[model samples]
Target chain A: MKHQFGDRRRLLQLSIAAIGFASASLALFIFMVTGTALIVVWVGVPVVVETVVKVRWLAELHRRRVGELLGEPIESPYLRRTEGNLLDQVRGLLRDPATWRDTVWLIANGTLGLALACVAVCEAVLDLLFWWLPPGLAMRAYARLSRALLAPSEKSRLALRVEQLTESRAETVDTQAAELRRIERDLHDGAQARLVALGMNLALAEDELARNPGAAKALLSEAREASSNALAELRDLVRGIHPPVLADRGLVGAVQALSLVGPVPVEVHSDLIGRLPAPVESAAYFAVAEGLANAIKHSGAHHMSITLSLENDLLSMVVRDDGTGGADPSRGTGLRGIARRLSAFDGALEVSSPPGGPTELAMVLPCASSLPKTLPSYGTA
Target chain B: MRVVLAEDLALLRDGLIRLLEANDCEVVEAVDNGPSLLRALTTHRPDIAVVDVRLPPTFTDEGLRAAIEARAQVKGLPVLVLSQYVEQLYARELLADRSGGVGYLLKDRVFNVAQFIDAVRQVAAGGTAMDPEVVAQLLTRRSGDKPLASLTPREREVLEAMAEGRSNAAIATRMFVTEKAVSKHTNSIFSKLDLPPSEDDNRRVLAVLAYLNG
Candidate 1:
């Protein structure tokens, strides 16, 4: 009997605190009104942004208070944002569905939400004075009201997913364009120039054949050397585009071949039974390659290992090295480039490197089962 | 030596045929696609099969596959694979049987005609003739192996030459050392790698390659 009285006293105190929070809702209502009214003018953008920011803070406070009354924490539904310029920040705020929801929440809480708090206080007093009403019923109703207005709807979740896809697609296209330009530059300066020189050397050798046999021999040798150099450059360029070994062998075999070239020995483990999609394979291969290169260049340690596995349609790759373990993706373009490459395939890269020890880089890509190739059906060309 | 050649490009095929004939090797048959090459290999049973890595009908490692398949049927069948590029994976696959009659070289090696013919002859005699590039890659791969780490830098060089199927005299010529020094390095390498002494150069190469591929 005494415990029941103590619970009602605590409920009465919480109801009073809930009524106190209602006063901030009126301030939010005024800000929304002022911000919306001034949005037509040029100076209204910053005001509206500030208004949204305050609304988020107030909504967070309401979520906390309501969550406490309901006995569970409410998750904030706002999308994460990086630092941007004023205009971009404003645009981001306007683009977010959560901001609009917050505005609606502010309006609802100012009117009906305030009334619920008042009714809860009246009920708490009436029940406390003479056990005539159930305790905390109005407060429970207020918590449900806040939750319905504040939680992320399904449409908002879909919008967030679309925004992420748009970002990654734009980045992938930009990276591809840059890669094409680099390839063009490499051909222009490396193989194409070498071939032109080889042709000129051959023509000179022909001219000097009758007049100067020794000069002709020297020119012929130069032509041969030039042709060899051109071939070497083209081989490198082709490897950069898509390694021939990768075409012949799958990802594991290709990575095995790649491991043979670097100074450090890499032990590879795999549970992949068959091939993945070509683009997924390529992306994963390059990401692992980048990891190996980074380990060799930066990690002063001696050993490295690569492991690949496929489980439940998710392909996972992990590259680990025992070296000085301070790797920052933002500081180096290699890791950033890997992240960008993976994002195109809806893959993700994760780095875990504590100071003074081993470093591990993990990546995951969702892919389907291997498709069987029609090798025997291919006839002679 | 009798040879069966498979190359997709007509111009290179003619040049290779002419080069082989001039060097006193008989071209028993020459074909373009993977299936025809397989048929030619089975029919002629040539002393050596000079195959390109990329052939027609698939254009992706068709010739290498056919060569490997033929070797599987006719055990220890000599095959010299040429490719625009070299891959350690293909080298390992060709050597996986631990058979001595295998040669893998870059197409650029053909520009050095004398060395190229020497490799072809060596392979036909049931000896391995790996490209120096592939040898370098194998050496890099085994850098962390404990016994290889015990070798001196000169010994490592000698080991690389040996893995490329070089005779002690050839290694001496290449390294500007006497045959005696090359032999000393080879003996030390064999002892360090724990291989039994052998007189046959092909067996010696097979042992060295088997150790590296291990």
Candidate 2:
């Protein structure tokens, strides 16, 4: 009885969907024809592009509806619109085979599709009147037809992969540039200025040495103090760039060093025996650092724990804190920055923070085992 | 005192040679790379070897690896490792063998020539000289440990000074207290940390370091 009721509901839904599809198909057919006719005057380029976009929208609606009926989601096959002037966008749209398939689908749905939709509507009506007729067979067949046209092809899947790589590459370049700019600003405002002051102090001290010993000694001390400050600033800047510990000791050791200085105690656990690629280690280190920083600043927690492990070719790291939760990646640039940094290396970040308690941030990255690895013996007793 | 100095840059190497010579310590051999440093250490058997952390040909802890290997070859070889930065991990590794003659210091510490020479002399006399930064990290890392937690604030300061391989007199001078007061603080810290009482200062330092490394 439940199955029958479900089928009846599905049949009614299909009937309404078919009516909508029929009207939309007719409207799209008229637009395509008018736009094609005006193309000789060149005023219809945008019109044709706009019509193709509308057709894709119409096709997407049917795809979702039919996919729901079939219990399988249909993948979108359209190429992402490339960024450029109007001509490039138009050319890209026209170059895609899926656009042509969508055009053909629009035409076929206008005629044969109209007929199938009408059949569906009639079958739904007949089922209500005569309870012996099968409720949703016609709707199932229409869904299959739409699926055949709208489902993603192998070529489109490759195109989707290329789209993803291109986006991540661009983001990585931007992140590097921003990092370089930050280093430059730090040097300019910090060590560089201090060094200049140190030099000036030394020069004045040298001149005063012949005149008075006490003033010269004071100036020399001032110069020494400036130089020390400069060194400290530069050390910090270098650590920010690439921690020397990360180079000397691998990721786990570096994180152990990081945990030592934080306000709250952080317990670190790891089973990683060999070093990962430097970039992967660096990314994981910064991600954990950001996670710890966030927890310390906002979580109001007393203790945190970091766990790292390697299995197969994947590296997994988790930073868990026992604190009041509610960490939103969209709301915090720290989390988003970690995401962007990881995405560059085909890595992912997952945050699970419920409202009341322990927040866990897990990161996973594929570290190919074929790369040469240094077995860092952190035999620190 | 005789020394084998290994630093990559020519200017700093020359500066270090002059500094040591001015302090009445002879630099027996000065080399720029890891292999040469190891060779110098083995052949000269100098009183001490001052090595950089980064050196050619690999340039990534090559000097440190060479120093470790040299120590393995020549037991109790005093090595003073210097770098722009310091790590508690590296410090612990250097001290893992528990050989008394070892030191790890930041390159910046050379600016204070008297204290730097003092550290070198201390390490040469079969003692330890850890950078204050590394010692501070040791103190903080073990803050949660039970023994360290029970330390009074004054005792904790004395412990940090001791972990940096300072003698009681040096620590007392720095803390602006008498040597007697510093020794009292050290005794209190040893009792609190449950360390076996020893007359030798280096043993006290090594015990404090081992406890902190936990």
Say which candidate scores most in lDDT: 2
lDDT tens digits, residues A113-154, model 1?
A: 789889988888787887745677897888898899888777
Using TM-score, give the best candidate's number: 1
Candidate 2 error regions (>4 Å): A1-23, A34-57, A78-99, A113-141, A153-167, A269-275, A309-315, A366-381, B42-45, B73-75, B138-142
CAPRI-style class, candidate 2: acceptable
True contacts kept of each: 0.68, 0.42
Residue by residue across B76-186, what tens digits does model 1's lDDT show? 899999999998778878888877788999998888788899889888878888888887666555455577778899988877776676777899999999999988887
lDDT of 2 by residue, B1-214 (tens): 9999999999999999999999989999999999999999999999999999988876678899899989999998999999998877678778888877889999989999999999998888878888988866665443565667888888878877776778889998999999999888877877776777675665675665755564
**10 residues in a row with least lDDT, candidate 2 chain B:** B136-145
Looking at candidate 1 chain A, the ten consecutive residues that score lowest on lDDT are A372-381
